[model samples]
Target: MKKQLGNNYYNIISEDLDGEIYDLLLTDVNAALFDYSDHHKSNKLPLKSKFKQFLINRLFVGFYLLNKLKKRYTGEMIILSNAYIPLNVPNSVTLLPPWIFSPKKKSFANWKIILIINQLKFILKERSIKLLLSENFKFLVDKFELELGNLFVKFKLSAVVVPNDMAFFEKLALRVAKKKDIPSFVCLHGLPARYNDIDDNRADYLIVWGKGIKELYIDAGVKEDKILTFKHPVYSSFSALELQSNLSNVLVLSRATCGIPCESSQLILTDRSTTLHYTELVKENLKKLGVNKATLRLHPSENEDFYLKNLPDDFFTIDRSSKDDALNQCSLVIGPTSTMVLDAIKMGKNYILFDPVFNGLTLEGMPLVSPFTGESFIKLSNSLEEMKYNINNPNDNISYHELNNFLSIDSNDEEKFLGIMNKNK
Candidate 1:
């Protein structure tokens, strides 16, 4: 079937034949397999149709293979996206079906399917064009354990693609990939170990934080061989920036404790989705307390208008130029758990970890599924206040050696991981 589709003598397909062809394409796994030159003249689509086609295309699961086949030669990659294009893209990208994506409907994860496909469609144009999927194929339809047969089918995919680990796509893709024998990659963004996704079968490739994260994965069940690590792409240049020294006295982040060896001087208010309007809440609460002397640093994209309208003029807002700048002026971080808490530790700053459960974990009996505990985690959340009082008092029990061991990273791991991703590298 693949050979027949690759054959040049085959009649050039037309949109008039789209429905019938789509039916035939569905019968064979290779039906939509296409070459760059064979598909003639492009067509524009209405925004609504474009979005519908996008949803259908994601379900197909054949996109990665088709995109990879195109890499046999350097050509243009065409996709459907409203986002800005990446520079140095190997192939050209364009919209095929013009449709606006809607997320309001819930057809048993139809919305989630559309979002992942749209993202891949967007990324494909910049990277190597691989394969394409039919509009309705899914790797794991439903279940935690993989259906061995479908898992094997998915293993053949050139890449096990997923948008974000939190997207539920991560758990399913990794499970399928594990059964089929392939690498599964996950991108992490500041969600704590709250999700039990640390299973050994979680994923093979992880885009996570520094060395601490790698150990976390190891502890979770991922074998060393199945893991790949890299700094978040957003933080690749973090080490290169000059550290701003003259930080302000007011901090916007949540995890901070005063009077510690690394105590913070800045007044703090961390952002949570529950308190996007925290400034207003803070103002009201402060007014009740009769206190009015604090500066506010924003949590990136909080809705300022809601709070501004309610607050008085004396309440100043800290407009951090960027995430990096926010880090500089931050006095102390306050949160239950965060990768950033470790970052603060790395920077030798003061912070307070306010875990919802202290002196214990959410998992009472199962350590594998339990939250952080023991000396390593206690340092961030439970010990900060105690350490503050004992400033200048040395304790041989403070296992700095163990802490360094846990935090240290094998720098050579990056080259090793890239070697795996790019066979020729």
Candidate 2:
């Protein structure tokens, strides 16, 4: 496909077809697969009938109505609420939903007519993308452009901050901000899983947690100047606590059964049988380490019932406390390529990457990157023998230098955030 379309492939999907928007909505195409364009032929979405599309197009009416009542944000810096977890932006900055931007218009008829015309133009534009993109994409583009474009015209937004650039409304907001010359920032919430051109700096500035993440982006062709590195508050304010003396309680950071459709080429990476098999193995191994009372800290998306139904009675208990509290309870934490590894280490607990190598790759489909991989303070165990060796010899860990490499806890993160907010001023 790359050879057939050449550079036009990029122009068509990104600009002409608006691939990112469709990728976020439909989950059929992953726009982040720009470097791996050959995957397109295999992942093409089946086309829907024009009648079904017309029904889907009506969803825009609700989207427009939702924004109609939302009062226009009078503040300079607007942070999308979803990004608030990682980026604790100051209270002075007005936080709003990514979709609610356009203010109430006088007449709905005028907007309806515009919507109809845009849908017609979209359906007639490119035949190649007809199967990949549905009328849902056209209406989504119309809804966001109409709303965000209007919001920009009504108020001079100083800057826009979002959790990521891949989501439908978030990416569109950044684009609108760029067109209006407003500074845009992507405050990454967690360690990035994929590093492709489409996943690079979509905003004017990419605010990351540490140098390691910045390097990943840089290695993927993003310029150094485009990224701004800062300490995450979670690490900056984290004072080292004494390791739990009684090593009775244990925590297993179990992964979600399904991958996020928007982020993956395939959704079901590891099946229930595979996940349950690993859970039983973890339980048996814990017993060997003289630990019996262990709890399962499942991914936020997973249900407790799935594990309860499959696993043997009295295998592992469920952890339902807050993340900080949960870490405080467990002296040792075990997981496979999880972001929670940092949390465990920050709380002065021992963390092991219990990665059972499946065909030379971790459970997340790729090998762990720096800080998590290579020589680090954290222990990594790929096999049952390696797991036993690392678990038995708790002192095999390195120093704090690697943690700093992943997330520097020395910087004034709040100050840097304020500077970014006032950059355009």
Taking all chains together, each candidate's TM-score versus the true structure is 0.42, 0.70
Question: How many steric clashes between backbone atoms does each model show?
Answer: 36, 0
Instruction: Score residue 76 of candidate 1 by CA lDDT.
Output: 33
Model 1: per-residue Cα lDDT over 365-397, one tens digit each: 112222244356334333434424322222221
lDDT of 2 by residue, 328-378 (tens): 878678876667866776777767677665676655455556556645556
On the 0 to 100 scale, the lDDT of residue 375 in model 2 is: 59
Instruction: Give candidate 1's root-mean-square deviation (CA, Å).
Output: 17.0
Off by over 4 Å in 1: 1-163, 168-182, 195-200, 207-211, 229-248, 254-292, 296-321, 330-336, 342-349, 352-374, 377-404, 410-419, 422-425
lDDT of each: 0.37, 0.59
Q: Which candidate is the best by TM-score?
A: 2
Q: Which ten residues in a row have the lowest lDDT in candidate 1?
A: 258-267
